[model samples]
Target: MKKLVFVFAFFLCLAISAQDNYYTMYSFVVEPQNEATVYKLVEDYYSKNKPEGIYVRLFENHFKAEDMKATHSIVFLGTQEAVGNMYAGGGNVNFDLFITKLNQYIKDGAGSAMGKHIALNGDTSTRYPFQVYLLLDVADPDKYDAEHQKFHSKHNPPGMLVNMGNVIAGQGTGHYNRWAILGYKDMKSALGGPNQLLSGPALAARQKAWDAYRASNGGVEVVGSGMRVLLGAW
Candidate 1:
């Protein structure tokens, strides 16, 4: 009886500790009219107070879906304590401070950052319903620029890449710990849409591509992970 009770207590403790890693996602819709100004602000923020959560990623668009200039910018924050400390520290402490510092540092930069907090929505009761992917591709420098430019011409996202080069792009927000492999079906659903444009047989083909992608050293893959969607129509 004591052993069973001890095991239960241990699991309960783990569950509680796990909650500490909760991440808050902030998404923005940048105005194209202020694209230049917004881009400047992004660079300024990245320079002054380097926050690891800020990730610039590419989300390809498919038929029936809208594509724009920039894909999306993501910020991966650690546990609540990580965020709390950021705000509590004051100067250069929180995001607001980062903005203020940027504004002042710039010679004649007039632009502001706007964002909305995304809370946990949908069925939380289900264990890991959504799939999270953290992909890192080799810095082809040239290819990166081309693909990003193509992604831009195709999709008009609200964010911009103030500075681009041979660098590491970190992309993941919310529920960082979970799945490590991208399920081929889900990727197709997101990219191709439910109609299965890849074709019935192509479904297996996509998995093959994913497997090949994983095998290649060009990209790092994290699958089965779950995250709360902050923006877009879901």
Candidate 2:
């Protein structure tokens, strides 16, 4: 009875921890005339006044999607509250100047989404130069998440960051339940190919795991996957 209670408590703690780690992303296309100005302003602002507990990364979309266009910029926020505060004209240092420049230089419209981290692997501190965004339609979120976590644990690659998040609110396709961010060191590394983390026997093992996961769940469908180049980060 005591052992079972301890195991339950351990898993409960993990669930709470996961909930505490939140991410918010805003995607928008830069106006043709203001592209240079927008980039300079963002770089200058973040360099001077870095936000507390927030790791900011700016990405430019590399691949074209049916719904999304190239040159789209994605701002990744480390905290959920940061999203609300950022748009509410509060919290961020130099908010007035930042908002003013952003409004002046960028498009008026943007897409936003908030999600909590389910699983993560590799170095989270160092900023990578490129990222692969995987938008998925999950049939069984819980089971799919478990398999994803297991896969990363077994075949995690060095210098590669893999993180999965469950979308709770905001824009993009309503069918996408979860998204995964795969960070790579450089453009060359990113373009090298898929399943870079798994090799030899590990690759086989991962395939088997995926097969089992698919069999159990109705089957996972990938809505869209795109690569993005890092523009600037702080």
Candidate 3:
């Protein structure tokens, strides 16, 4: 099946220029018995030291590969430079402290990656309660982005915003090149399939656009997907 990957970039102003948004996502395979402890620790940590200019959200992978059981925390920063500062402990909060607390309950350390946002729609400010992530690989990034943006302009689903970003740093997962994050107002709105959200004509148009998008990009493949709920934010 051809995968549908969406896009989003960060909002930043540097030297009077807005920089492309960057993202750092940490995927953790928590020990099953320690899930509660891990969740509590994560929630508590964020509550106390909320980082600035970064949006932190957590998710449980509702659908994932059998070997990829995990919960993910995605941190959105405005610039690639910000990503470096964050990891190097230049941010307002103590990342080392956060990581120390995180290591105790995780099965493995964490799978981390960095990417740049390419496209975004709807209100990026409002916090949505649920989100779906589409990990994709595209043969041609430029063509894929053009077609996807065209599709979005004509057939966007109501109450849901789309974002796409390309992986630029972090562990290179050979299969994925970009990410599509679909934000929803609530879980109920999120569960509604695309067909249900759009009228017949709009849905058809979307499908056609997607087909063209796939063709132009030399075929897009969905390597992974996950559904997450909003956790406490700083």
Candidate 4:
């Protein structure tokens, strides 16, 4: 079985940010033999602290870029206000303790990105626990965004949620400025099955549009692409 190749997905920029959801992701290296311990600590922390309208997920990175310097990523999502104030004026003893404990299992921190939710298609739920993320360097933001919406609305699967965003504040962004996240029911679905994958005219049209997009704006580069398993969400 082969996963659907995450190619030519037009992950647009600020002009497409109509959704209020914002997200931040921390890329970190895990201490050897402490993966479970790290996850448990985070799970315990979120389970107790209990913030409103905030979502958190731990992702085990697979086939990630060599330069990433991380085996896992912690992603936090919420309304702009909630996310911006997630750690604001923190004075809680428990929260401070949680951080202290968490740091022990983390070997090193690589980078992080804060972005706005640009567009969303299909369903949004935990049912789709697997994801594919393509970090892209977008040139013509509006053009790609328009084409992306039109293409996915007609060709995407039932539960396939496609989320795109522009990176507002990012550490180690390198050359990429946007991200396209695709969700699936499970690893098998994410990796694909016996049936033919994305074939036929739909794929062709998308490729053609992508080629044109590249021609006009120097070129669009996929900075990196990889799969992630969702470990926890809250």
Q: Estimate each model's TM-score.
A: 0.30, 0.78, 0.75, 0.79
Q: Write candidate 2's Cα lDDT for 103-166 as tens digits.
A: 6656544466656777888887877778888888888888888778776776666778887888
For all the candidates, what are their Cα RMSDs to the real structure? 18.4, 10.1, 6.8, 8.0
Question: In candidate 3, which residue pairs clash?
Answer: 6-164, 6-180, 7-163, 7-164, 8-117, 8-163, 8-164, 9-117, 10-21
Ranking by TM-score: 4, 2, 3, 1
Off-target runs (Cα >4 Å) in candidate 2 are 1-15, 74-76, 79-93, 194-199, 216-218
lDDT of 3 by residue, 7-64 (tens): 2334343342346667777666665687777778777876776555565666666556
lDDT values for all models: 0.32, 0.67, 0.67, 0.70
Clashing pairs in 2: none
Highest lDDT: which candidate? 4
Tens-digit lDDT string for candidate 1 (43-139): 5555655533332321111211132222233343444444434444555356656455434433331111212121222233333222333323433
Candidate 3 TM-score, C-alpha based: 0.75
Please state the error at residue 108 of candidate 2 in Å. 3.8
lDDT of 2 at 129: 72
- True-structure Cα RMSD, model 4: 8.0
Clashes of each: 15, 0, 9, 0
